[model samples]
Target: MDNQRSLWAAWAERLRQRFSFILQGQCALCDRPTSQVFCQDCTRRLQACRVQSSVLQIAGLPPLYSWGYYEGALKQSLARLKYGGRPQVAEPLGQWLAQVWLDSGLLERGLVVVPIPLHGDRQQQRGYNQAELIARSFCEVTGMPLRARGLIRTQPTTAQYGLLRLERYQNLSNVFQVGAALQKSPNLKDIVLVDDIFTTGATLKSATETLQQSGFRVVALFTAALSERQIA
Candidate 1:
């Protein structure tokens, strides 16, 4: 039974990979043919908006780094990934983020990458965590170890969109807890929190505080895009 299960799993993975390759050949922004998620024209235009400073400060949280302002082609691509069931969009977006991390001279040899976790019920509904998909791609390009099980969302919260800033913070308060697997490993030091977008810093701050309370040092927050309101 185990051997049969393994065979089935391998076959499933191959199918997933084949589908991803076909998806990759089409530009995510304009639907033009290209070898990456974004075609050459879209890539050039998107790269023009790269954030000048690689690091940003959020009130009472670790320094955050983002690839670019969440607008134009980048914004549409993220929306597709997060809401349109386009998991393949994370690949090129995550590669760009990983390149930014490397360019910032923050690529430590042993730093662990942790994706912001979704509540169990929410993840089941979405079929996958968008942050995890991006983090997996980031790890693949950077060769960094991903520690997704380090943190788990303990409670489901209402969506932060359209909520007041204070409400957003309150919504996420005390919602994250260190996972059992990570609690068993006491040697974890430096960590990078990966997320698809940085809107109000509520989620990252809550997760960072949870890890810190557990004696883990969250070195930084790395995200694909920074919301326009936050950038303003």
Candidate 2:
């Protein structure tokens, strides 16, 4: 049964990729004609937003790493991926993040890629979890094993968009638990949690603690975008 499920999932992913390639249209950010999610100009702009990982020093996050700052093209791209019904956008962004991680000299053995999950209700509404989508692409490029369900969101908390720091922390508290995938694979330790955005660090903090309490070591928090301000 598990083998069949894996085969079907691989087939579905291949079909999705083929369709995305064939149906390429306007850039998600600028609506300019392109064969990819973002046009060449927008892609260049997004690349320009890259920063050294050393610059991001949040007080409570695990060895944070992000592809770009959450402003300008990078910000718009993430918004389009998360809210504009464009899951295809995650492909290139995740690949770019993988490239950055490779160049950063942080690659290590025995690390598993785990995407921060969405609660079932919200995930059902969104049709997909952006973090999982991004992590899929990340794992594809980096050749790392992806445990997409290593953590689960057990509770649906309020959206953290406009919430203050205290509110964001409160909103995410007790929302996550180590998932069944981790339980089944006792050898899968030293996690790298992937998410689409890093705003106040609240979400990752809660997730890291949950995994830690469950006997897993969360080595890093990786994201596609990082807010320039601690509170975004």
Best by lDDT: 2
Q: RMSD for each model, in Å, please?
A: 10.1, 11.3
Model 1: pairs clashing at backbone N, Cα or C within 3 Å: none
State each candidate's clash count: 0, 0
* Tens-place lDDT digits, model 1, residues 1-232: 9999999999999999888777667777778777776789988878876887768887798889999888887888888887877788888778988998888887677688899999999888878899999999999998988887789998999999899989999999999998875777677677899999999898999999999998889988999999877764
lDDT at 111, model 1: 81
Query: What digit string (tens of lDDT, one per residue) describes model 2 on residues 1-232?
Result: 9999999999999999878866778888898768977899998999888865623656766778888888999888888888889898999988988987797688899899999999999999889999999999999999999998899999989989999999999999899988888889899889999999988889999999999998899888889988888532
Give me the runs in candidate 1 sitting further than 4 Å from their true place: 1-25
**Over 4 Å off, model 2:** 1-24, 52-55
Every candidate's lDDT? 0.86, 0.88
Residue 53, candidate 1: alpha-carbon lDDT:
77
